[model samples]
Target: MLSYELFFKEGLYNAEFIKKFTIDFDLLESQVEPYTPEYASMITGLSADDIVTTAREYATSSGSMIAYTLGITEHHCGVNNVFDIANLALLTGNIGKQGTGIMPLRGQNNVQGAGDMGCLPNQLAGGMSLANDEFRARYEKEWGVKLNPYPDDTQTRTFDRLEMGELKALYVIGENPLLADVHMNHTKTLFEKLDLLIVQDIFLTETAQMADVVLPARSWGEVDGTYTNTDRRIQRVRKAVEPHPNTKEDWEILCDLATLMGYPMHYHNSKEIWNEVRKLAWEIYGGITYDRLEEEYSIHYPCPDENHPGTFILHERFHKQNPDIKKSRFVPVDYTEPLELPDPEYPFMLTTGRRYESYNTHSQTRFYAAGIKVKQTEETIDIHPEDACSLGIQDGEMVQVTSRRGELLVKVKITEQVVPGLVFMSFHWSETPTNVLTLNEYDPISGTAEYKACAVAITKVS
Candidate 1:
């Protein structure tokens, strides 16, 4: 493992802070052996020489950055994986500076924005802790209402609540959980049990098909809003076309629904809603206004006031002086095996991801003629040539992939991108329904399903 010290603006950190954090770091790292290049090679299947060379370069570099995507989060130990990444940054003193620190590529556009707008079940806008008394008081003052100290269940737990008849209704938007969530059959059963299932989207997705009420919402081109990209750049999304005659913006729909339910929501337009967000989430998005978005094209959050230029690099001092902040603490984590391991029966590891031709679940991209032409019209499993030969499977031939949960017959694309004992498939086509074969085991903390690794057996389709 790499060893380094904490830095502040080219100078060493305060002696007291460094000593305390060093003890904490040492205690955490003591739980496991140092990850030497040989150990990494054994675990990751990379060459030892390459691993050593890469480690040397990474450690000796003036500034280094690490970025990852769903591949890191879509695991049974997703939260721990993130902690380990953070630990690496801390060890190397690569944080709180430009061209350094960690970056997690969002799975979709506006995913960061959604969280910033308080879409999570546990936290309020700007990542204010719902459980914190001070955070609640601040939001209550801004919202003019008492806030719920205890947050509700996460999306993963909704199915459990529905199964127990505790959750009677669900309001889904922009996501097709039926085709996207792990254990597709189980998700479908839970949807069937819901007393009321409401879906709002631009298209009738598989989940919408089962909804008791489907509300058509305006598409991106028809709505004016802001989308925060993976790097925290909040960009304006102006209406480029009129919404469909029968549809309206999602905000308008929600406002109407809230008013009808006797909880009146008064917002003249999207801008009004954004202004309220700015008032409440002043810590992160205070400086990002609709007017600024139009003028600058985009602005990063933690923008404190109107005159303050939007911050590009975050954690200038690593949240040292901000209100309601605490000194950073070292979180040590150890590696764990995947929840589901390949066995003699299921001898191959199956991993799912996106293709360039399609976005998540093909909500919109499938209909694009050019995208369809660029990729295979249907779902195909990517297999190494050696694995296909052993299974008597030919290139472009049909193969049956079976897990304990379900099975699918898909065309095979023999390639070297995947190792011999592993297969990769894009979960983009409804026809293939890849989620059916994915394990339902999820990270205990993040509740993100283990879509990156699962055990499945493959055979040539007769």
Candidate 2:
């Protein structure tokens, strides 16, 4: 089989690579040899014996599922990491079948839906690229509006633009950038300079407190809408109670704002908006109506018509439908060390992630009784017992963790969960905001910050 290593060796990314090769899966597989378990063990930290056992088990199994969270996508090489996952699945023939798939566990409830509806800066609804002439034309005809023919700057670039005075206004919805953004000090400076900062959310978040306008929107229980889950299941949410006296539903507020801005958005209710969404992206959402949702509870996307059942596993007849494009291609990537490394001055590696009790930024979770009881009110840094002892820090003692950008005071939890040279923290509390110490460098393709790794130095304060 043509292994990815052979594909790279054949000058696939060079000027003459495409002209010299064809996209034939069988031909390419035959030209290259698959890597042995020992080779994989060299790159990953896993032992060769464990790797061999895992390889055997996976190959022998009828179906297997691979699931990962931000751990796989919160690095400088995040995009390539996802590509590596896809390569593994394709090589093992473990996709597009029941009981087998590569699933990304989203951080939030509707994150998958947001991507499908084209919340990305580079694409329109349903991930239709503005750069694609055919896709752009079709969307323009369907929406009766002309979209920018070029991709817009990503959220990272947008912040840079705000700092540079290139952009003035920022309308934030359901996000608390002050507490959540990498390099919290820098993010604060950028937000302060914006001529108009509008925040729409259920609570007065740290970011919302700084905004010129804070529009109070109804919470989940007071709104009626459809939510798409990580598995692409479209499920309906009904109103359990009326909205607060001062608060309006998110859609109603948005529509009223649009009307005032001369767009003339006159939707009577949430279902009217749903009908419009169905009309705009019929292939994925046509059969998913509120009535159908009441009957079936939920339906996965690619539900083309009312009579059609929702797709469970995707790509059943993919190769048959598109002989050339349906099959997978092997793209080779090289591993690079993280941008920041442990130096003599900052001789510790820092990683940040979410905890079971606290969600991102704690905009709402901190208010929950269960979330509060699961952990202490303040955030604590998890450090190895060896590191804590070496640094003269005891468990429950306060420590000052400093990075190149900024620093924060967090409590020390001496545990063996982390390695000797590494420490971990979650950005759940304002008292010990971990983002202040995180580096601002992000993945070039996905524009996601490198939150998984950075260099830091810690000093015991107590």
Scored by CA lDDT, what does every candidate get?
0.80, 0.79
| TM-score for predicted model 2 compared with the true structure | 0.89
Best candidate per TM-score, number? 1
Which stretches in model 1 have alpha-carbon errors above 4 Å? 1-23, 142-144, 318-326, 370-372
Instruction: Give the CA lDDT, 0 to 100, for residue 250 in model 2.
Output: 80
Note the residue pairs that clash in candidate 1: none
Q: Which window of 10 residues has the lowest lDDT sum in candidate 1?
A: 1-10
lDDT of 2 by residue, 1-462 (tens): 112443334432222222222234444354334544455555555676776656555544787778989988999899988876765566556667788779999999999877777788887776557798877877788667788898898898898789889999999988998999899999999988889999999999999999999999988899888888998898988899977899988878888998899777677888887776677667778788899999999999888788889987786653234434433575545556789999999999999998886778888877886534565577889999888889988899988999999988888998898978889999889878899999999999888999989999999885
Q: Which ten residues in a row have the lowest lDDT in candidate 2?
A: 13-22
